[model samples]
Target: MPAFKQTQRVHDDAFDPSDSASAHLYISFGAHRIRMGVLDAQRNKFVALEDYEVERPSTVENAISFLQTQSVSNPLLQERKWQQVRIGVKNQQFTLIPEALFDLNAREEYLRLNAVVEPEHEMVHHHEHPRLELINVFTLPAALHEWSVPQFKNSPVEFVHQTSALMEGMLHMAERSARPHLFIYVDKNYVTLVVLQGLKLEFCNSFFFTSSEDFIYYVLFVLQEKKMNPDQDAVTVWGELLLDSELHEILRTYIRHVQFGKKPTGVGFSYRFDALFNHRNFDLYSLHFCD
Candidate 1:
């Protein structure tokens, strides 16, 4: 079996260029845990760092436990830069008592809580919406507007600008990693595509397909759409959907019509942040998908 390599990041705020950034961090307030890594930005691979988990507790003692666990005689505790702790709590219905305690500190902020940590949650929710933990502000993206997201009452899911921007940012981050190949994630039943530029170069892209047949037709249709002849350019797919045989064949059938190459296959399921966060803030957004 191939060994798994780990990376640690401490967020850009924690890094001072004069000092080497030994940590890379991806934080999910809902998860209450920070994915950390000491990354070789050059290789875009993780080195190592301890994963810090902040738990969900309602009492002052539990809060104390969080502080102690995270601050216990650890090397990170010794760093002055790590001292200005800012806490963000997930939205909870903690009776009036705990809620008042949580408001005592200016260093703390509360955000609506959504993700759960049980194994079942990882399997169900995570897969159902692959990009949840990876996007901006810990929410789903806008592209999910077309999905029929389940909801309370008779409402539909909504998309927002910030969420879209964050997803776009994650894609651009992958590109900035300048690593070749694609970073694929699927959760729920939505698919997201992102290609990296190992050379640290930037390129433009257009949404090319939604299905195998769509993949085939779009290639040729887009060429004509852009006033280009079928025998013009080349195409390469970087998606899991390309793994299916039937779709692959469908893609190949129309390859001759366009200068693009290969068979078409399939895709991933994902969630964008804006679509699933802050019910009070974006109440109009129906949790259900588009009609």
Candidate 2:
């Protein structure tokens, strides 16, 4: 077992969990961290937020244990039975396919042919586009699904790939923008890039990197391959980055319009969350948009 570092914030100290109103629970799990948010559906405000980081032996058991402990300690989680629960898995071995081309019967074979490892224990999941009638086909580990499924058995639960949620979130955010936009989400050991051109998805992929150099290399490579003008195209970044971080500095050196992303405009958050960066925990916040 490993030690887990946890941080949490309560939006309203006067909030009464015994209230009749129901709330939604959103949780996102990564390689080393877990983030959760409790949203009051009627009030349209977040009541509580939490983050847990496992310093060593970052396994599924440790993550689940951390969640279990939080459920016991956090009053907001314990007092109220949530109306809906959604889990976002941040695994990288996923592929996206259009709705028309998706064949439900060949899901496992499709993933297997794409070189997804441990295909036997992975289940296919999909995220439907809001207006295009398109769907994203991806895989989630059975271990995570099995472990989390039982926890939310009493309520309606849906499992989504983090990338799918991010894509949906970005689509909603970028719908009003006319120019081409590149959205980058950085995590512990991987970076996900999503490109949108006039509300249409142009590209979406994830790359693993060991250092800042490798990170920048992939970004630049994608830009060149996509024929996107680094000097003209706009780039919005999110997740695990500070103003002075090495990754931010490197991106600035090559890209002209690099800026941090903002929280989704559709959701309401309490003032207590003002201290945190608007771009952080994008996947967790975006989970609200997941169906």
Residue 259 Cα positional deviation in candidate 1, in Å, after optimal superposition: 11
lDDT of 1 by residue, 1-291 (tens): 121122222233333422223322221122233322233334333222333333332333333344344444534333322211212222221111122234333211222343332332111111011332221222231112111132111222223222222223333333223233332222112223233354221222223244656544544554454443434333344323333455546645654431211111121111221232121111011111111
For candidate 2, list the clashing residue pairs, or say none: none
TM-score, model 2 to reference: 0.91
Per-residue alpha-carbon lDDT of model 2 for 145-239, expressed as tens digits? 77666666666778888888888888778855566678999988789999888678888988889899999999998898778899998889998
lDDT of 2 at 72: 77
The estimated TM-scores of all candidates read 0.28, 0.91
The global C-alpha lDDT for each of the candidates, from Candidate 1 onward, is 0.28, 0.78
Query: Candidate 1's C-alpha lDDT?
Result: 0.28
Give the clash count for model 1: 49
Q: What lDDT is reached at residue 38 by model 1?
A: 30
Candidate 2 local Cα displacement, residue 154, angstroms: 2.3
Find the candidate with the highest lDDT and give its number.
2
Measured on C-alpha atoms, candidate 2 has an lDDT of 0.78
**Poorly placed runs, candidate 2 (over 4 Å):** 19-21, 76-80, 119-121, 175-178
